[model samples]
Target: MIQVENLHHRFLEIEYLRIGEGHTAIIGPNGSGKTTFLKLCAGIELPERGTVTISGKEPRAVNTGWVGEVPDNNLVFRTVADEVASALRFGRVRADEIKPAACAVLSEMGISHLSSRATHTLSGGEKVLVACAAALALPPEILILDETDTHLDRKAAENLETMIQRRPAPCVLQCTQDMDTASRADRVIYFEHGHPRYIGTPEETFSHLYNTEMYPSLWRIAGCI
Candidate 1:
């Protein structure tokens, strides 16, 4: 669970909010404090005032994995396999165990074929997948996806979504512009300005946003939009 109380940051202000475990989607217009809230949750930025906690612990105290809008920015290794093993190496895992661990993680993510490829040789979508595999390799308790599908095509985006839904992490926070993807979440948070205007199941939240572009396409075909 993630708990926020009287949170205040550069562009975010929330008196209180609690998000339970499972996948939760964060959606809002551009510059609506969505990313700011994500950063706070990821422990990348401390709140100016108030508090944010995950499972009753500060986010910084928990192991967190993150992937952002730009995949290229996430890669710092020469090869995909090395990228996946980077976290393990940083954590001082046995040198001999690195390759097998990296291989296993890549296989689990269905990207074993790309393991030997150079990071610079990968396509944008491939880079995102490699980055995602790297983040998942160390098994974080908190996994954050910050518009990671922004650059993916339909097929790649769907593939990424499948990976997200099947994630090993108990808590997943995804901030995305894709309403279809947002609608698939267990919970939907609708943010406006710097506040979460609505937070509930997708059915409940989308009802409040019926006339808006935020309405999911699935609902549109079903006439809920």
Candidate 2:
């Protein structure tokens, strides 16, 4: 399990508050420190105070994998197949086993046909799928996704939902603007002014946030309210 203790981060006037785990969704308006919080949780950025412990170990200790908000940020290999296979290499899997492992991941993600395609040529949605597949191939103890659903279409989004449902991680933190995604989370966290204003089931959090003026107007515009 992931445990966050008295976490406090600030950049000028912005601050990030403490948070815990269990398939949590972090929802907030832009500039509410959502991405910064994710970066801190993923250990890309250190907390100025407090501690974030994943499985009793720091995030940096586990070779933890992350799927960033921008798909291109995760891209290193030229081909879709190569990108998926990179995770296997990171795990020290043999060269001959890489192809089958990559193929399996691509198939599982419903992108087997695009295995040979260049990563840069794939559409935004396809790249997101590829990045997710890469992150899941090795099955990290914690999976942190930042705004990954924005590029996905309805079908791809459904596929991603299915994939996440089957994830084995005890801690999954997804930062997303999509209510459909948040609605499925075990817990929903609302961040306002860099602090958690609400934390509970999707229905509870959404209902509470909807009635308040602090809720994002886009959620109402999208009919999620």
Candidate 3:
């Protein structure tokens, strides 16, 4: 379980929030603190006030795998296979065992063909997939994505959506602009000016927003405009 109590940041504030298993998507307009919230949850950034915890531990203390908005930001190796295996190497796994481990991870993610490709040469969609593969190599208890769909094409986004739905992690969270993607999540949190304006199922959240002037683009996407 993940809990946030009296959380406060530069542009974010939450009196209390609880997240129990399953997938949750965070959505808001630009600079509404979507990425900031993910960073806080990923343990990359600490909240200046209140508390954020995962399974009784602080976020930074928990094992987390993150895929950021820019795929290149997550790459640490030249080849796809190398990047996938990098986590194991850092964990001090046996050199002989690393290659097989990386291969297995790629196969599990259904991207074995990318193992031989150069990380820098991969297309936008391929990079996202490779980055996801690398993050999952750790098999973290919680997975966080920060606007990973921003650069993906429709097909790539759908492929990513499928991968996310099948993820083995107990908790998965992502920030996105696509209402269609957000609608598929178990729950959606809509933010306004860095504050959580609403939290509920997609139907409930979007149905409310569709009638308001806050999310014009979302209404158009949902064909409610």
RMSD of each: 1.6, 3.3, 2.8
Ranking by lDDT: 1, 3, 2
Q: CA lDDT of each candidate?
A: 0.88, 0.80, 0.83
For model 1, what is the error of residue 104's alpha carbon versus the real structure, in angstroms, after optimal superposition? 2.3
Show where candidate 1 strays beyond 4 Å.
Answer: none
User: Could you tell me every candidate's TM-score relative to the true structure?
Assistant: 0.93, 0.87, 0.88
Most TM-score-accurate candidate: 1
Candidate 1 residue lDDT tens string, 64-173 = 88887788888999999889999889768899998898898787667899988999999888998899888887778989989988878888788766766666588999
Model 2 accuracy (lDDT, Cα): 0.80
Candidate 2 structure quality by residue, lDDT tens digits, 1-225: 666677777841223334455688988888877888788778998878888777678878865668898878888999998898899899898989888888887887889999999999989899999999998888777888999989999899888877776755667889988766787788888877777777788877888877655354656787774
lDDT of 3 by residue, 167-202 (tens): 568899988877777777888989889888888877
After TM-score superposition, what is the CA distance of residue 201 in candidate 2 from its true location, in Å? 1.4
Window of ten residues with lowest summed lDDT in model 3: 210-219
Candidate 3 lDDT score at position 194: 81
Q: List candidate 3 segments past 4 Å from native.
A: 91-97, 212-225
